[model samples]
Target: MIRTSLASAPLRVLAADATPVFREGLRAVIDRTVGLEWAGGTDHADAIRRGVRTIGPRVVVLDSAVDPTCTLIRDLVEINPELMVAVLFRDHDRSPASVRVAQSSGARCLLSRDTEASVMVRALLQAHQTGRYVDPRLTMVLSRPWQSASACDAGVLLTARQRQILALVAQGMSEPDIARHLDLGAATVSSHMKETRRRLGARDRAHAVALAYHVGVLPLRPALVAQRGISPVRPAHTD
Candidate 1:
């Protein structure tokens, strides 16, 4: 039997894919899986909404290529925050913009269509429990240095102290806590934070952490990749 830590009933899963053959194949996989129940599959956004309302699935697997912006994913989460959304994207669609859209829209996980069935199931299960999952491949992609010719070029680098401070911040440490841990005064910590933000062009601590991860400064946390991109579309606000 498939060993699972899931409580109570099997996890209910719904899939939305524009291609009929692909949708049926995914449904078949879910049906054969031990701890998953194939709620239903749909090719249209309207039908997906109806299926969620009728089937009351705990997880929805969405095709990012079909719904690039993940508007439906956002709508579903808005309706039920407890519902986990796992997005499947084509290899070509795996751009920084796509990642940002998936993150900002509150998608629990992002996967490639070629992802193995077992891995996909694991991602779904992890997303249900932790509310987030970043594919290791995506982590590799995000951790690479940027090649874009933007204001913040690939040559931009963080000092050793800045990297250390960012790593602590990524671990959810407060400025004061980081000061105590590093044997530095609050003022010194605050000054370092300010300079970090300026150098990374981050709007706040969370953005700084995201930038650090994107630039391969801070290690990637498989459970939680910052939803926002290095330079998010919207103005960054304090989290």
Candidate 2:
């Protein structure tokens, strides 16, 4: 319903950035661009979630500097499923791994910090209309194939419903909250969760979450930066 009305309106674009220059520049550019309006800028990821729900922006331009770990995109998407996130990556951070990290964190579009003003504006419009836009300069990076090392990247796939439910679980949402959020009955949500746990070979909800992070099916919470890449499970062979 929110997105349906935004189709004919000037879709609002919020900046999940704290930098003065970047936010001001984007605001100025968006003000002049047709079919796009500047919603506002958020200094931290916490405020981003609030703005996303209250402001109802169709797209969010998140600066990598503000969210270096790229964890906020997934949470924002959970708040508004229709939202599109475009990460503003640093020029030096152009690599196949970096692209995959951003995509895995739920960013649908990528833009370089040094990208031309005109190109950035074009990308925003493209994301709003078509739901994606990658920086043309990064096209070569995509040519390299991704190596599958984790279960998530291997053959393991989660159904859309399972992924959504698991995401809510990752945020520490209770089953009832998830049910209300997704408009599913509590029992239905529980059933999907049980299946997800079984698929991951998790013993419980907490175990399911840990395995989800291990498999790259979920991104690490920003607070757990120091623990990044450290699996919670110890290999049986280690014994």
Candidate 3:
């Protein structure tokens, strides 16, 4: 099993959700978990912003329904680029659209509302340390092969490492996280990201991920599942 070396420091985390019940329960959960601390909790996006600034937690876990847009997530990241973010989603609400939204919004980890407290804490700690978390179910999603541009297709040419980085980006790891995972420098990751945006005619990282998905370079995990044994889904616009 893949594992990250444990950090000597306990991870500090901030929790944000409009629901009082969820916030309290999550706080309790994290307090009981090892190597994690519940810095504070908030009920509004503005309050979350304020709390994160005040406490300077290593990670912030937000309720997905509370902030569904990419703009809001990006704003939070801009508030503190070093803060790792996780989104709390409902199990009944899992869908391709939701997954896409979560990725576009810069959430490195996702926890189902039905998830156990222990699981939630574990996920939070993972994000705090590695900048990415994949629950057993989501891990399956992450492992699916991303679509590559067609052999004859000409606009963008991505090297093998670039393609791997694209997949990690689609999985919502920040530039530094990608650098850490790939053992490359942050500057190198930034360079590859810039090239991806330029080659795919994308405006930003989220846009690049969307373009990759739409153009068939990264097929939704379920879509690929349904096609079992058939010819692989071609990258978009290949024909």
Give the number of the best model, judged by lDDT.
Answer: 1
Alpha-carbon deviation at 134 in model 1, angstroms: 1.2
lDDT of 1 by residue, 84-182 (tens): 888897776565545655666778798888898788888888888887888988766545443232214322466677778878988889999999999
Measured with C-alpha atoms, the lDDT of residue 169 in candidate 1 is 89
Cα RMSD of all models vs. native, in order, equals 14.1, 14.7, 16.0
Q: What is the clash tally of candidate 1?
A: 0
Off-target runs (Cα >4 Å) in candidate 2 are 1-7, 145-239
- TM-scores, each model vs. reference: 0.61, 0.59, 0.56
Question: What TM-score would you give candidate 1 relative to the actual structure?
Answer: 0.61
Task: Give lDDT: candidate 2, residue 124.
Answer: 74
Worst 10 residues of 2 by lDDT: 230-239
Query: What is the descending lDDT order?
Result: 1, 2, 3
lDDT of 2 at 173: 99
Q: How accurate is candidate 3 locally (lDDT)?
A: 0.66
Error of 2 at 111 (Å): 1.0
Residues 66-96, candidate 3: write the lDDT tens digits. Answer: 6644345666777787878888766533433
Instruction: List, in order, the clash count of every candidate structure.
Output: 0, 0, 2
